[model samples]
Target: MKALVIDDSRVMRKIVGGILVDAGFEVVEAENGQDALDRMAEHDDIGLCCIDWNMPIMTGFEFVVEVRKHAEWRDVTLMMVTTEGEQDQIVRALAAGAHEYVIKPFTPEVILDKLQFLGLVEIEETV
Candidate 1:
């Protein structure tokens, strides 16, 4: 599956994008929410989005709300990958439309675990 990694920080994008690519996803990246929306318009194969909460032009929360409005994007799963770790923020994101939330400074395993919850991947047992 294709995944969009949206973040204002180039380094964060690289980190998240690398994780998804390692998980077998074709990765496309955008610096912010608006850029991501534009990329999505061009790529119909984007099944997942890893979004950062704070962005210029449009925030990740706004992106979630806006994407949920489009019937064409109904099957796309949104996951917020941000430094905002407050419980209320987590609840708000999920209530808005995010399928999963991962706080920043996360290990790759944390992200893969969330992907499993979203049914995007299955991590094999390691002995």
Candidate 2:
């Protein structure tokens, strides 16, 4: 599967992209919501999106709303990976069509677990 990692922080994008890549996903990095939309236009195979809440051009919430408006992108799973940890913020994102929510400062395992929960990845048991 293909995953888009959207964040204003280049380091954060790299970290998230690397984790997704390690989990067998082809990764694409976007600086913000607008960039993500642009990438999506170019790549119809994007199945997942990891978005940041706060960004310059467009907020993650806006992105979710825009994506949900398009039937063509309905199958794309949206995950918010941001520092906005408030309960209301989480609720808002979910209400806005985000499939999963993960606060910033998360470990790769957290992301992997969420992806597994979303059925975007299969979890393997260790011997």
Candidate 3:
């Protein structure tokens, strides 16, 4: 599956991208929300998007709102990978149509498990 990782931090982006890649997903990188939107416009194969809450040019919340407004992108699973741990932030993200949330300082296992919960990750045989 194609997954988009949106974050301003190059390190964080690489980390998340690696996790998704290890999970058997084809990864796409976006520096921020606007960049993510541009990618979405060009790629209809994007099945999942992992966006950071705080970003320049456009915030994750704003991106979520914009994506939710469009019918064509409605089937794409949206996930917020952010440092915002407030209950309000969680509620707001869910209300804005995010499929899942993962706070920062997260491990690859946590992200993998969450993706499994969302049914975005396929079960693979162990070697």
Q: Tens digit of lDDT per residue, candidate 1, span 1-127? A: 9999999999999999999999999999998889988999999999999999999999999999989999999999999999999999999999998989999889999999899877899767767
For residue 19, model 3's alpha carbon misses the true position, in angstroms, by 0.4
Q: Whole-model Cα lDDT per candidate? A: 0.94, 0.94, 0.93
Model 3 misplaced stretches (Cα beyond 4 Å): 123-127
Error of 2 at 58 (Å): 0.5
Instruction: List candidate 2 stretches off by more than 4 Å.
Output: none
**In candidate 3, residue 57 scores what lDDT?**
96
Residue range with the least summed lDDT across 10 consecutive positions in model 2: 118-127
Q: Pairing residues by index, what is the TM-score of model 2?
A: 0.97
* Model 1 TM-score, 2 decimals: 0.97
Candidate 1: residue 75 lDDT (0-100): 95
